[model samples]
Target: MAVSSSLSSIHISPRTPKTPRAERLEDGEEDVELELLGEDERYRATQDLDGTDGQAMEAATSKQPISAKDKRSMVLLCVLYLIQGVPLGLALGSVPFLLKEHLSYSQLATFALSSYPYSLKLLWSPIVDSVFFKSVGRRKSWIVPMQFIVGTLMLYISLNVQKLLDDPGNNVGELTFIFTLLVSLSATQDIAVDGWALTLLSQDCLSYASTCQTIGLNTGFFASFTVFLAFNSEAFAAKWGVPHLTLSAYLRFWSIVCYAVTLWLLFFKKEDKEPATEADMSIKGVYKTIWTICKLKHVQLLIVMHLFAKVGFAANDAATSLKMVEKGFKREDLAIAVLIDFPFQIIGGWLAARWSRGDRPLRPWIYAFWPRLGFGLVATLIVYWFPKPPISMGFFAFLVFHTVLSSFASTVQFVGISAFHTRVSDPLIGGTYMTLLNTFTNMGGTWPKWFILKGVDLFSVATCKVSDAGVDIAVKAAECVSDHGKALCKDINGTCVTETDGYYVVSALCMVFGVIFLVAYIIPTARKLQALPTSAWRVKMS
Candidate 1:
């Protein structure tokens, strides 16, 4: 859910002009020249040319200053992006922490499915891009309806969530289904906003769109994660002399905010009409382009790498915080740790960008890979030795330090790979190229999580100790972990006692796999890929 800022920085090339000239390449080779126009400039050029030359039009637009309308558009974009982040933050950050208290790791794994919709949204993005009602507005046709639906869904969940979570039936499947829908809608909104951003701002100030996305999305996520968790905690609320907010109340507040924003967008904000000269690719063409890109040998190799690269960190990323919570670490403390690490993530990204410059953009990523993996191992140790509740200030500080270090390394790797993505992505289809690579990268992190979580329960050894009418008896821990099993165990007055936690076992296995992956694939493949000329990454469109 925490996307790299580099994604927003993609350079989408303008449509190729009908007339072409020759230009010299850096290698002293001559090639046909393609002029790049910003989205706004392109739109203006298509309207009432009046014999104005392309260069003159470009110069005029370049000198045009930002207006009040443009500033309003920027603010609108930030709010839209912020709304998009809400469902994602709830699904990925807050819900998991809340569920871990009552649900088994396997159930939590099921809930993890909610986050996959965002990752797989790439599959449907072309459809969202290609189809829209022109009268209403290309972006608004999707954004308004999707956001409205998101608000409605949030309202529905706000009313029913408490009952669902507290139900003895263990409604994780229902929760997953509903949250999946919510997140899917959010992804749809993201697609629309991403497109709308192109024309919403002046050509000269277009780069600010990415800045808005980064700021808006991170702020929204922080509100939902750190602020929500802190306020939702009884101890934290009591300590601060504030009201303890429930998840339901939090969702309701956001739902109303979503409604307010969506209403404003529906009636107040008008999307700029797309130029008639600009033709969107048909959905079929979009799919064909993706297929063509996929067929390239370089792309194939990169996709394969993205699919498996995160396997090493799956256990640590997915289970470490939950394991710490299971060991009695308070959610408030966890939230605080995240709060402190937030700034470091930004700093790490900036540093990674600085380090990733030049020909080998992937060098920093390759360098950080091992340390990041080691941090995963270290996280497991931290969780293993996590002290009892009412933890000392010194130990809490260490935990914060570990989180900052791990997050810093992860951010470096993320930004470095994203920088490489920027370097190789074809400007003509920058959004699609970047989305394809990002989707694969997100999947690599997502798919292995459920298995890793399930592995914890699989490798764990626990037993139910029961005193049946004064006679001692033992039952399988699995028989006591489920909702029904817990009730059955309670009927017999039994307590589930964990002998060997699966966290340690799973973490160890992940460490071993990390080493294997690093030595066998990541190092060699990254080096080879980075050394390849940029030409290898470009696909020739038919």
Candidate 2:
């Protein structure tokens, strides 16, 4: 059967008669009519060869009916993705602020190097596909061991966090090593889980995979980022009987959770293994499959789009948290902003799925692009006007508006793009191909941060002066102007003093790329691409 993404494209029927333009104006529904291509015509568009008529019909016969087993499969996949999210949440959301008290902005970015392992995971995906223990299961063999190591590492960190906190300078190297190791293990486990999903879910149920990922990931992020931080706060800790909540305690809690989940997976879950083909059983075959995917014309275009799609707002996202902190936004304030953003994100995903269902699977991308660009500019302004005085009710109103608008637009765009990738990736190499798309997306968001950090280092300045009594205090460059005009304070009073301009420039770059891709590539090509049936991506393994 044709392996289509659950969030598949709209099948426009060619038989619909053309109508006047007036039909589109009724109730905001689109009225344009076009010839709907048959599934065979769509499938042929993605094929490189002729004469597979009998095989194509045979392929269509593989569709299976849903039963209780299918429902259990979906639930297991959701749990697997959720488990993948916890450590990821801890790494990206919590680690920055947790280390903020000691690390400078530059140091924080430097240490955040650990998080980039996820972006590079495609490099080792072939190995993940090629090797496994026969006793447990191919995917489970990797998943269980990786999770065990990850849990052990978290517990190890919990035990020694006090020594590290006491002497951050001496212990930072160790902390970075441990954190990087933790992130690496979590990323590897992701490979196993993703591969398992491909094997477990039926084609009809595959589209919901991205939805499951978004929900589970966001939930885990809220828990690790917001809830854990709250638990570690002085107010909560004291109220809960601990006067001082050490990092060890916070980590230990998660360590126990990880261990419990590991046990659950080992005993409670059963993997019904499928026999591996010759290519799947060998490393050479894995690379050959990867090579074949890269050579596909549509897949090649997708790689480029995935790389540049998010470039417009990358720096803004990376700098927002630190910029907020510099503007006196507390940890709780950042957490609250994310809390407001989360549900809107999930709603956006649901909306995208609904909108993509019938005649225009790519419609969300077109509709969401303009808002994303507008809000990208709006977010830049919010960052530009950092540390505004009095922190008024109106200020928070703007914050809420910005967060909600941006989150909605971004989530919609993400859902469309993720579904598009899934729709086009060959199922034989599903895990590896999907990882490649995600790796590119992650890299698009990452490379810009390096430049943003470099600009911050070059342009922004921070200084502390020590008094005779041995008290040291931070001094804003604007404050030093009266005492040190021209000689030291030139261009230091406002706008030019902070890295806000860097954000503006980056946001503009993203908008330029967005327009280029939308107008030049995405809009013109979307209709033709969507016309191709989901079967266009399927191939017999070599």
Candidate 3:
């Protein structure tokens, strides 16, 4: 909701009275004297107080919008969100596979290079916020140019992957560098898109707006990843004949298409009315305001609960696909399995929409939470028991089950957090608050990647040794060399460096983090729901 009315809280004290007689008598003022303005004129459609009747004016402006035009903006922006997600997720998942398999680069290195740019984008958001393109207005200004750049890079990457791989003399490093730049550009587009989403939505309908936004975003993401998988598979058998790198090339092609569509959209989007944003929409202010919100006792528990919810997700994302791989699924097969879960997200979104129709208390929303969490645990068990099973009809069955459970958990999480954030954030800094919270969640997801990777690597090496002689740094270096290659094992500043075994390390990290989160965040969140007043959870709305 881009709507802001706190600016209307203007005060005129005894010491600072209303406009002086002379000032009030300016030529323009004579057109409609303050006294003649009347009750209705004073407050009509205003977001701020001015001239006179500030509080009285605000009361009138507080009415919810009834326009059909305004309502449709949510649906339109949701479509954009859902569409953009495909390119984003395709890039997120497929690019790494392409690099590791075709180019012989490491997945960790590729992910950090590709994905790191997105997380670091907070650095540039202020520029996006404060500055709008003079010709196209702020949102369009940033979005249009960046969209072209992302598209161009995707096309470029697709065409050049082979040339770079064919010759050791060629510079894959430059290709990676170019890819990083496009990521930065794409992330800026994300920032602008979010701002656009906020502006189009009204203050009165934030809950609905956010629900649609999440659904659209997840829908786009799921679809894009599926498309990526399908395209990757089909491309693997295509004329390019670049086996391992096929998906990456196809993803690049997809990015080009994404950029092209976004560019086309640039022409269609209307210019936004100039709105005061720094005083209203800045992310820096969120840092200060989040502290203030944290002090509320009732809300504080929800915030902690919010923090706890991520433990499962954080652990799950860090290792799930790799686990699936270890369980003998091919990358293409895994991609197909993931594609099967898309419908569950829609189901979850529909349920949330239903829940929104009633004025129910937040607790009965709790019923869905346990089943979602239980589904995750069940899926995990099934996978573990059938570890390394062939991809059969039954395997697809488990895949659907796991995906539905995962989607349910994701739905519950989205609806809960959106509801929580909407309550806590002041309308004055709502967009800023949401972005900052997203940043925290990003940290939650990212911080554990390497730690998990390293710990799992160490455990795997030690388990393999299992000797009283003790595995020294040299032994670890040898193991590293064995796992990766001799080039990866080297000495730095007279200290030994080794390439950690990725398979064992990834498994160990997931298991450990999964157990911790299962006990800590998931259990506590469950407990909170159980403790909720009985009357709160029984709303029969969809």
Candidate 4:
């Protein structure tokens, strides 16, 4: 069977001839009209027709049943994306809480360096897109090895993580280096999987690809974060009458899981072969395509939008949970909040995916932006009002409620944007194209984090004090800011005292920036971009 035929069996009914324009407008209820096209023709068709145009040309494409191949593809995508999320969840979600106990905001900020690899993966995405062992499989060649490496790294980290965290000197630099490598490997795997997803599913159902991504990634994140924290927390274990799980043991288990998953994929899963007339796979060609994509006005606008869009939420996202922890909210309790939010996030993603369909895929994203930002402000208040220990059930319930709302908005924005990306991305260079957009999106959130964390320390007013009999002598502010300085203060029997908390200051400023960004740039630019034809997002290859 021809590739298109094997992918989906279209059933177009006989109808009276009509003008192309009339056919497009009047045939709204007809079965999807899928045409057989050679690789070159398909590429040209993609460039000429935006996602909306493509859907219009297909009429009511939703009537078509998903092929078995597409079903298999969806399963493959979910598994691959789930595996990809494990390390990220551990790095961004769980590790920060663990570090917050012993590390200063500055030290935690330094640890944020590990996440940069994910944001910077676009730098090498072209290589991943272009170079692969075609015989082994375009994507699998990269996915298999990268995942194997990831599993190995996890095993290594499992062995050393506890000792590294326990060291009085605190191995922030070393941990950053190690996790950076892990995240980089995962990012590379992500590029491969993203590319594969485009080819795996038929064009009509492309949007669900992002849905699978959201569900799978969030599930992995929940497992590594909420479940891990709950299991590892002594308080949680004691309260629940369950065995306490060690971080090392948890990491080792996932490492083994990673290895098992990797082996399954390598042996059991088979990648589809690319057609001979596919786009150029050369490094130069892929880079050239990236350059062309960058030159597009729409892509440039989206990049700028992605870079500035997350500034408003940076403080809430990066610091709120840690701040709550600083203020005596237990990690286990925080985990409970996340657990409540988890199901809602998945539900939000599903709803967003449904809402993100049609021409204006960014509609839901645009709608959710302000609400998400508003919740960020609310988060600061929640943290500020966080009660001292022996907290009431009502207060915990409120926290969970706030978390669900905040996460729901965030999830909607994420899924909506991802759906828009899936619609606009050219599948010819799916890896590079998707990676480029995703990189900017990730960078929008990642780049501001380090500064946000550092700002907390910069704005904080604290003093190192030593007791001389009944009197206390205050040391310089500079002497208590650095980890080394704090250690030195501790050596002389001095304790750090906080006069002012910077979380409020930074969060208030971030909310202001968010409002400014939303009004001046995000809303207007997003509206304009969404109104543009999908052709604007496609690179016109010569």
Candidate 5:
């Protein structure tokens, strides 16, 4: 919903005129022209305008305008969002599954490092917003070079992945550092894509922007997590005449893809040439405008909601993946399960777009929220009931069902929140504002995973020993180190051996937070926020 028409309000104005001028562009669409009024006219506009009344005055003046949609631009935007998801899926999805076999719970949690760049991007967004290469245009100038670097890094990593995986526990540092750099490059490229969308689409075309993003991101994730994993599976590797399944082959394949896509976007994508505005010319003005946006009441509320919405289910992804491994599920099975759920996520997104519109914009969140909580609770019960495992086929079936349901619900909720942010965002600072909101949303999801990993370690007990046969064996406890004299405990080999019930603890916590937020915050906030005319969300600078 990138389609806000708050251009008049985004500027610093003494008083709004009774009637604003509408200039016709060469494309025959009308756009607002920001102009100041004389003293008498200013007085008329400013009268009875202060505090809440000023907010009301601002809402009344910033009307949504209609413009023609561009099919080509929408397609291009989707492609850009898809590219942004590649590194994200690699960091959040692919690497976790690969590492589960080699690393302990604590080491697995460190995978969150790859996503940290997303949470911090907001801090640097003002700089991105204020400066860019003039010749190539602002957005592409940043995107092209960053994407090329990402591709080069992917290629280099593909070549060295074998060396890094040689002794994964010992090499965790090298792996984390390299992947962190890949994710960082992807995150910076995301800043450019977000900002580019504002200038690329007209106000009328904004609503579809979220739809494009959801589809594109999910598509990219599918390729990176599901498809890539499938290719790296033993069955596929053997069929394709490969000797072994390693991340190296997958990374090498995607490296080619990244480079090709970079070339296509750099050479062929056309961007609108935006004339430098007052905010665009001044660095201080950029920060000042961001400060003003931050002061708006509606903006503040949206930011809080974005940060807390995911707290309820934040740890589910990490916890569930590790639990599946503990239950004897193979990495290939996990990947395929996610692949099956991929289409459903797209369907959920489509349904959300259709249902959560008009007067009840937050309906999708409400409809999906209860089911999500129910699934989390169900997961807890399942974990509690089957505490110890030589995992059964029944457990695998149940796991698949839970993953599918949760994935669908997550997609629906994400599209709803993303659409809300799009609708409220000012086109003037589209990239910065959108990235700012998403940064909080990403952070909310991230911190809980860290807590979950630490919680697992806290409740679990594990030990290892050298057997009489001279092999290292992991076990719940040791009879006597004196018996096997060389025996000692190691974190890497420490399974969730004794305190396996920790999974339920994390699940229950997710449910608790979900219910509290839904009742205490979401229910009341949605009513008041949705009731306001979309214009009420607009920020006015004076």
Candidate 6:
């Protein structure tokens, strides 16, 4: 009898087909066909000597079936991601507005207060990944206790008053620190959820889950934020004798719900794999696996890409609410406008993926310079749209512009990321392939905010009203005039407009970079596809 060794699908090789044309694009889909080199090359080995062992390893790992239990876990994990958005929206974006109205701190400080916790999540991811208390029991383990801490933290904030509202002399630093601690704990819960999620979802399903997760997060956040805002600003006021609870207090109440849910998950679930220190790890350990992935060509491209993709939209993502406030849009109007825009966003993302799935080549994203140039034209037209009014509607103007551009590009992005990861995941290392993608994806996510904050500091905001002819003036005075002129020019009557320069400039810049990257991302991806050895596409049976 011959001894037989089944392929062990514990490792993966990065030999997926080159990114499809639709996926190569950051904007719309790429449209290149994978034209393999001649028939002779059909059997040519894509795995050179350097990649052969890796390819075999991948083949071993790629086909593992996800158990039904695991699938359920994965779905639950994704829901957590979606659920993540609610508290995030309430605390991060909504709190800043409340703070702006109630606090003495300058604009920059207010922004920092809200965003600090999210940025530091990386610091805790490691800890969350490593810790396991067996006595606590199950995959959920310590999550129950953490939930209590998180819940109590929220409860504390919910009942508390905003110190900034009363005495200007009150210490904002202390209040914000406490707030950050609470938020940090909340973020830790997310890290734990993602850790658990990774274990639950099958490798093949990660991208789908991620896309769903993204939508869930954004949708949850928006819904929760809206509810909170309504209660804090409107409903709370309607209550008898009670000082309408502050936004902070409402945010705390929201946390209570999250914690309660978290506790339930703890009782119901347990980790699939317990903590393994480096000493306890296998021959090819987590660090080694991660290191191998980081060294791949596509991973490098992804890292650089993380910064570039977001840099183009840095101002658009983080500053929108504040920008709207500055632009004189009422909060209520801004809220409504966003509600309208978000649906379009979700639709755009779904269409990009679903549409690209058709057309054989599956080029869902259309990233041509010509199309983007057309976008630039539309942007310019928007700037010049309608008659100039006396008051500034800069906020509304910017919102509409960003909503259009961001949704269009981001939809394509959602698709591209899915396609890219799908292409990258080795059919052999079914689950681990997804793990690598998620890790890389997280890295990509970090850069945008990093670049955005840097860009905010690097760029100066200067404004000047258009004189009969361009006139010389002090920059600050011009900026003041520009700001005031913008504020004075808006009405629901649509009768007044101002000559807006800022949004127009930003839109133009977005187009410029959009076109440049579109060209850059497309040509190489197209050429790379055409160069892949035909044998790479062959279905070789061992």
Predicted candidate 4, C-alpha RMSD: 7.0
Between candidates 4 and 5, the TM-score winner? 4
Clashes in each model (backbone N, CA, C under 3 Å)?
A: 0, 8, 7, 0, 3, 33
Give the per-residue lDDT of model 1 (tens digit) for 1-542: 24432242222344322111111123311221222345653344234343345346434544667688678776887798789878878888888887766677787888999988777877987777678888887778888899889989999999999888896236888999999999889877876776666556554555345545655676687778877999999999999899999988988998899889888877876666655423336787767878977876667778888888877888888888777776778888888888888888767766675565444567888887788788888888887777778799999998889888887777777767866765555444544555677778778888888898788888878788898789878887673433444555676688777677787888888788878987898888887776554444544454
Please give the lDDT score for candidate 3.
Answer: 0.48
True-structure lDDT of candidate 4: 0.75
> Candidate 1: which stretches are off by over 4 Å?
1-78, 135-137, 194-214, 263-280, 353-357, 426-431, 467-472, 479-491, 530-536, 540-542
Rank by lDDT (best first): 4, 1, 5, 2, 3, 6
- Evaluate model 2: give its lDDT: 0.60
The TM-score obtained by model 3 is: 0.65
Give residue 282's error in model 2 in angstroms: 1.0
Worst 10 residues of 5 by lDDT: 1-10
- Clashing residue pairs, candidate 4? none
- Tens digits of per-residue lDDT, candidate 4, 1-542, equal 00000000111121111111112211222222212234544344335344555556445565667788777777777788888788888888888777766677888888889888888887888898878887778888898999888988988888988889896245888988998999899989988888777777777677778878887787777778778988889989999999999878887887788888888877877776766534456888888878877866667889999998888988988888776776678888888888878878878878887787665678898888788788888888887787888789999898899888888888888888887777767666778888888888888988999999889888878788999998999975652544444666788899977677777888989889989988898888887776654444555443
RMSD over all Cα atoms, model 6: 11.3
Q: Give the local distance difference test score of model 5.
A: 0.63
The candidate, 2 or 6, that scores higher on lDDT is: 2
TM-score of each: 0.80, 0.77, 0.65, 0.87, 0.79, 0.62
| For model 3, the run of ten residues with the poorest summed lDDT | 1-10
Question: Model 6 over residues 1-542: C-alpha lDDT tens digits?
Answer: 00000000112222333221222222212221122223322223322433445345334543456577555654564456544565566555566566554332233344445445554454444444445466653225545656667667766665564554453225566556665776566566655554443334554443344445545666766665544554466533564344554566565766767776776676655444333222312323433444554554545565454335433443444444454455454555556556766777666555554443321221444352244346445534544453333335774666466555655555555554554444444332223333444444443334344344334323434443333345533222222212322333221111122233344455456556856775687446534533333222222111
Worst 10 residues of 2 by lDDT: 1-10
Q: 1-45, model 5: which lDDT tens digit per residue? A: 011000001122222223121112222111212322336643443
Candidate 2 lDDT by residue in tens digits, 182-290: 8788778877766666556555445455666666666666667766666667765666675554567767877777778778878877676654443353677777767
State the displacement of the C-alpha of residue 304, model 1, in Å, after optimal TM-score superposition: 0.9
Give every collision pair in model 3. Answer: 86-224, 132-138, 354-542, 364-536, 364-537, 456-505, 457-505
In angstroms, give how far residue 192 of model 6 lies from its true place. 3.5
